[model samples]
Target: MKDTIKYVGLDVSKEKIAVAIAEEGREEPRYYGLIPHTTEAIKKLLKKLGEPSALRVCYEAGPTGYPLYRLLLSLGVHCDVIAPSLIPKRPGERIKTDRRDSIRLAHLYRAGELTSIYVPTPEDEALRDLVRAREDAKEDELRLNIA
Candidate 1:
């Protein structure tokens, strides 16, 4: 049998990550539960899910940043940093939870409805971080002088 692709959705946060998987075909996406937000946990999850070549993963872009995306890419997994605001929503569907988000992401991703954002190179990210830090420091200095 030909290998079936698995579209995996991850709801990532500072402490944990919620996971869901949508296998090829029309089956409803299933919640795969939560795991600690760490490299080891992610590697374990990938192993449990099957081959990296068969896994397409995604998560919303958030303050927790692109490290997870980078990690997945390094592991030979196709990963997307989804624009959260652009994720499709049903009318009046406001209830939000990590599990639900993961499931929705997986389903939408499988349907080719989710948009993947451009991920910057590590060097670019470092430069951006440096610029932001400098801006914050300047703001703090101004605020101190005003006090």
Candidate 2:
């Protein structure tokens, strides 16, 4: 049998990340754990999972942002930044946590059941930053005049 690829999902936060791994053809995740949210930690996770080509990874888009995506790209690992709103959740399912979130992402990713957002190019992100800063400055100016 050919070597099976593994799917990894991450629930990223400011200081830590929850990771889940699902091997191909497996319906359940094979591993799950937490790691510090740092470039070095990400690299170490990639190393622990073995060949870059054999791993597919994903994480939801949120306040933590796309730095991880860029880092994974730099390492030649395909990583999807999923749109949180677009992910499917069972109706009436209310309890949620980092572990459950990552595990769900892993299962969904392996089953081809998640939607991803388009990642902006570096130049595009820079332009977006400028526009945001301008908007913030305008808001500040308006607040000062209102005072």
Candidate 3:
């Protein structure tokens, strides 16, 4: 009974999520296909992937936010919110697709080349949103001369 680690990479969008997995060793990572952006689908995928303790998940930080990361954490799985801009890129690699991105992420993450960002707390997010809204309102007021 050896403890094997599975590095899972997710390319997340509003409607669907593309998954890839890199198991321990030098083998190439494999695409795990796409799943709907829903709790049930995600839970089912995790169940099929195997034990939570063996899974290490990561996805780029975008408008999708940290809900998925929080969910994985709650499920006792190790998860990381990747900094997309910091991910290493190959020269002239212009062809981009969800499948390719997921595979690349899994490979890079397994090689310790990906940088993870801080996951803000729910309260911190709320306060940041509030400040942004106030700033927008002030800018709007100035533009319309409605001080």
Q: Judged by lDDT, which candidate is best?
A: 3
Worst 10 residues of 3 by lDDT: 138-147
- RMSD of every candidate to native, in Å, equals 1.7, 1.7, 1.3
Q: Write the per-residue lDDT of candidate 3 for residues 1-147, one digit (tens) a residue.
A: 866999999999999999999999999999999999999999999999999999999999999999999999999999999999999999999999999999999999999999999999999999999999999999998989963
Cα lDDT of model 2 by residue, 44-76, tens digit: 989988899888999999997788899999999
Q: Tell me the whole-model lDDT of each prediction, alpha carbons only.
A: 0.95, 0.92, 0.96
Kindly report which residue pairs in candidate 3 clash with one another.
Answer: none
Model 2 weakest 10-residue run by lDDT? 23-32
Please say which candidate is ahead in lDDT: 2 or 3.
3
What C-alpha lDDT does candidate 1 achieve relative to the native structure? 0.95
* TM-score per candidate: 0.91, 0.91, 0.96
TM-score of predicted structure 2: 0.91
Off by over 4 Å in 2: 142-147
Query: Residues 54-78, candidate 1, lDDT per residue (tens digit)?
Result: 9999999999988999899999999
Give the poorly placed runs of model 3, Cα more than 4 Å off: none
